[model samples]
Target chain A: MGHVIRTRTRASTVAAIVGAIVVLGLALLPLVAGRGLIQDMFFILTMLVLAQFWNLLAGYGGLVSIGQQAFVGLGAYAMFAGVILAGIDPVWAIPLGGLAAVIVAVPTAFFAFRLAGAYFAIATWVIAEVVRLSVAQWKTLGGGTGTSLPRTATRDIAGTGWIEAALDVRGAAARDILAYWLALGLALLAIGAIYGLLRSRRGLALASIRDNEEAARSVGVDAARLKWSVFLAAAFGTGIAGGLIFMQIARISPDAAFSVTEWTAFVIFIVVIGGIGTIEGPILGVLVFFALQKLLADFGAWYLIALGVIGIAVMLFAPRGLWGLISHRTGLELFPIRRRLITTKGNDHG
Target chain B: MSILSLAGVSKSYGSLKVTDDVTFDLPEGQALGIIGPNGAGKSTLFNLITGNVLPDAGRIAFDGRDVTRTPPMRRCLAGIGRSFQIPQPFDRLTVFENLLVAATHGRGQGEAAVVRDCADILERCELSARANDPAGGLSLLGRKRLELARAMATRPRLLLLDEIAGGLTEGECTALIRTIRDVHAQGVTIIWIEHVLHALNSVVERLLVLDFGRVIGIGEPGEIMASQEVREIYLGIEI
Candidate 1:
């Protein structure tokens, strides 16, 4: 007889199967769905990617940063710079944006790491503002007014022609299909990478750091190093999502690129209302967010007020978020990371 | 050879000296008990040794290497493990997960490599029943056991326990002492800060007494307890 430690649950295995089928179905949607639905999905998928990255930083790493707009703005701006200035295709330029975001995140973390709690959150916002202002001074990218990706660049993006030919769609519809597929891929990568990270040894260290930094250090977990890594990773993922979003919109202005309300606030709200710490939280949160927007967008300020009310109510009643409430009741984990010890007889694998 | 040595160590917060020119040495594999009145810098001494707090002026050598400026994490990795005076378990983590964190990082091993050892540590600490529960929901005794279990999981050559025996029932204290004895018998050096005199006496080979941030006496357990200064300061008995 022996004991085996495993992190998998029956529910997780089933969830994995269901998730794969759902992703496959969504991947095939662009083949049959109208352009309007495709564009809507592109929006949801990109936002989901952004929300997951934010959740990893704030929810898992215990970093509540409101300055994620810095990465989004920098990434989008960098992509624009690559296409407009350097003649790189917008698709290839997206990775350049991610790289640029990582480059900026190092210094941002160096400064923001000095602050704690709410101070840290505010410092990240301030840094984002500074980045936004500095990017606005670059006249080549239209400075404060911003610039559009040249029609030539978007019309002939690397995979747009391939998608157009394969899906039997016009060039405009092909571009939308291309962007939608890219958004879907990015969402999958973001969630997959974060899920992998949260199950590794570093994930355990991160959880400990989130619980108590001093105790974590006493236990030999290097909280500072882990935090730096998480911050940079979030910045990289956010930057790519930003680049992808701007590629779809084909426009870039500092204000539009770095809008805290659109990028940071909405992402935070999704993670908070969906569930902050769990992977399932942001996935569920983005859907709720999209539904609320579709239902209430015509009400203008009332929409914002409704969101605020719902946010406050969730924080008060279900503090862990909606998914948290559900998971607490059902004991189901789609992406389970908690290890359980099971006793097994000899030659019987667990 | 001494496993730990503190020479002329002093720490002051503002004008008040918390550790005033203290010096001590403990040979390898010896269990040394520390007793002191409130505010006598007992926990402060443990902090200084564990690298949680740096001294104003002194050298601290562990295993013949100077570690005065090493950070707490590095010190833990260097085989100096400690339990907090207050139980500080990672509240959201399960008890077994808590041990996994300590074992993996403290030993610089991967989870797959340390999971078995973590389970053994859990069973030895008698926390097997609560292994899957969140540490925050644990009772006081369970938390204390977790504190001890976590430090032990670090695979330390030296363990520093701070008032871990306090706030437990007599039976609980006896059971804890038995666990400590089992650990001590395995030859891990121990520096225990305990107010439970009988518990301290039963395990420690030597006793050191502190009063007002100064070492009042150090000797065998019986000799230190018999000393007039120790009796007056620690026992509060008229000499």
Candidate 2:
């Protein structure tokens, strides 16, 4: 007889199989969907990518940072520099954006790690402000006024021609589809990577740190090192998303690129309202957010007011968020990371 | 041979001294129980040895190496595992996950390499039924068992138990003592900080009495419990 350790559940297994089918459908959507629908899906996918990374940091890693815009802004700016200055294709420049975010994150983490709780959160915001201010001083990227990608770069971006010929769409529409596909790929990568990480040994260390830092340390979890790695990793993902976003928009400004409201606040809202720690939360959250935005787009300030009201209501009623409330009642885990022990009657020999 | 030694370790918070020049040596595989009143700095002493709180003075050596300034994680990796006076399970993580964290990180081994050992510990600690349950939802005894199981999962050479039996019922306490005794019988060194005198005496071969951050007595359990100074200070009985 032996005890067997299992991490996957029937529900999660079903969810995985279904998830692949859904992804296949989503990947094929642009073939028949209108430009408006494609653009909307792109928005939702990119936002989902951002929300997932934020969830990893605050939800799992116990790092609440409001300065994620630093990475977004730096990534967008780096893409701009690569395209306008280095003459690199906009597609090739996306990874450069991620690199820039990592470089900035090293120093940012050095200072922010010194603070805890609310102080840590505020320190991150202040660092973002500093990064924004510093980037505002770069005259070649049009200083505070900002600049757009060169027409040549956008028209000849990698993979757009094949997309155009294959789909029989115009260049602008092809670009939109290309960006949409990249966003889809990125969203998949972010969710897959985060899910895999949470199921690994490091994820256990992270959970322990989140639960009790002192006990986690006593158990030999190198909290500081793990946090540093998470921060840098999140920054890298966010930077690439930032670059992808700006490449799609073909424009960048310090204010727009570093907009806390756009990059950080909305992301936090998505994770908070969806569910903070669970991987499924952000996916659920981004969809709700998209629907709300579409329904309330005309109301202006009241739209924001509505979002605020909903966020507060969820926080009060379902502190774990909407998905948390659902999962609590149903006991359904779409991304089950917990391991189970089963006593099996068998020989000890392997 | 002594597995751990502290020499003149002192710690102060502002104007108040918590640990005053405490020094001791524990031979390998011995279970030494510490009995002290509230605010006696017994927990702080454990912290100093575990590297949670660095001493303002003196040195700590574990396994023949000076660990006076080593961080808590490093010391844990060096085979020093401890339980908090208050159970500190990863609230959202399952009880089994808690042990997995300790086993993987403390022993510097992969999860695949340690799962069977962790499961064995879970059964030994009588937590196999609640293995998949979230640690936060556990009862007092369950949490206590988790604290013990987590420490054991680390495969530690030196196990430090801090007030692990403080709030348990008599039957529960006995069961826990049996678990602790089993751990000791395996040749692991243990330094337990406990106020439950009878339970402490049943397991530990030696007893150390602490008062106002000072060690007032250290000897065989019978002699230390019977000493006038220990009775006056720890038992609060007038001489």
Candidate 3:
């Protein structure tokens, strides 16, 4: 029994060390990369956030909602409203967008939770469309033509003497590098939060519901409540990603803000490529996906088609996903939510 | 005093009556066996008790409190734990994680205690070896063990086992029966729905034979098995 405890302690210590190293490495990347690379990194980080959100919803909660773009658009628009209308700082707008998404998610979850399986998926899609159409008809937020953050405001912020003063020693590349670091920090925080949530009790309930709704209910899991919590969380996460995407591009349009095809498709691909239901899978999947995108940038539309093909292939061959297959072989999980017993010679009481 | 009482419980789908005026009382810590052939509403009865299905017409009381309309989770929190006929472990979760969920959320246990109880339950179910393995990869016997482990994790005063021994081999069934006996010995009231007569006979003292949603016989297991009406409806040819 002592030997077993010792072994488990040693294993957990090693896992903790590895996790810390990985996080620290990610945290420091912005200090090393160039301006263009930093911007690209920011985009990747945003993608990672979306992937994690989708994974939590479909992968863990068994809520395969295609309408997550509703919140994505809502978040972008929230940023627009915050900065341009409400006069809130653009950076602070991200969390506001997340909060707005949560507010919307409650009613959406109420309506969507009534349906199950395919019907639930469809209801979410319909909800997204309703939001999209409503926003599209609103003449004030650049209904169809799209909206752009005022260039004057961008120039005013960029011209801040403090940024220039700081970059004087490191050159213009330093400012862009700082932005990259900010994006990377956000991504890491999002991933870490998800990791923590998944290791909590609520995560277990979500997993049970995902596996078998009826059985989960029989065991006293309130499937509706759990689903609602996950829905709001997912919406909050996706909305933050949208806010970050807009910050990187310095613009937001109704079509672009709500573009399900771009953000949702990319997120779905990342989570699918990585193992769904595992915290680290989406991060690894995002890294691989970004690598492929960079390598095949010249392929244009073919790049998207290739991505689709790769997603299909991954699903067919490794339904558990690439990270899932690797984890199966290595038996290494950075976020170890489950326990295992190691029996010793004298531990035969069980 | 009875911990649970169901009176005039009836459930129907369109024209078919799944539970027909089924009534029973479960005194605290009493083991009740529900035996019936296929489609005899044995599992449905358990569901009604746990509030999985609201009766079309009936009243249910738990600890003398009217809970006829209480949700499943509330019932579970009130100390009712049930296993599915087909063992449905959270496929993406490890065996230990699966039980930990029931312990924490279903029973509202603290995290450390939940972990301790989960480990103990896993050990008792002989699943300690495969505790870290994903639930989907388990064998039929392993799944059955997990099903029971999860239910026990809830720390229920009343447990409903729905054909947990159905798909297990004879050896596996015996092992399961022993584990269940140990649990029952701990004073956890059990209502088991089993087609496996031997397994039921070994564990339960009283048997309620159900057919077409009504109790055909209610007595000691051997006496109920030997009843003429129960033989005609459930036993049919032999045993």
Per-prediction DockQ comes to: 0.68, 0.81, 0.55
Tens digit of lDDT per residue, candidate 2, span A167-210? 99999999999999999999999988998898888998988888
DockQ of 2: 0.81
lDDT of 1 by residue, A288-348 (tens): 9999999999999999999999999999999999999999899889999987766567633
CA lDDT, every prediction?
0.92, 0.92, 0.80
**Model 2 chain B weakest lDDT span, ten residues long:** B230-239
Error of 3 at B105 (Å): 1.9
Superposing all C-alpha atoms, what RMSD in Å does each candidate have to the true structure? 1.6, 1.4, 3.2
Q: Model 1, range B77-189, lDDT digits (tens) per residue?
A: 99999999899999988999999999999999987778677878788889989988889999989999999999999999999999999999999999899999999999999
- Chain B TM-scores per candidate, in order, are 0.97, 0.97, 0.96
- Index of the highest-DockQ prediction: 2
TM-score of chain A of 1: 0.98
Task: List, in order, the clash count of every candidate structure.
Answer: 0, 0, 0
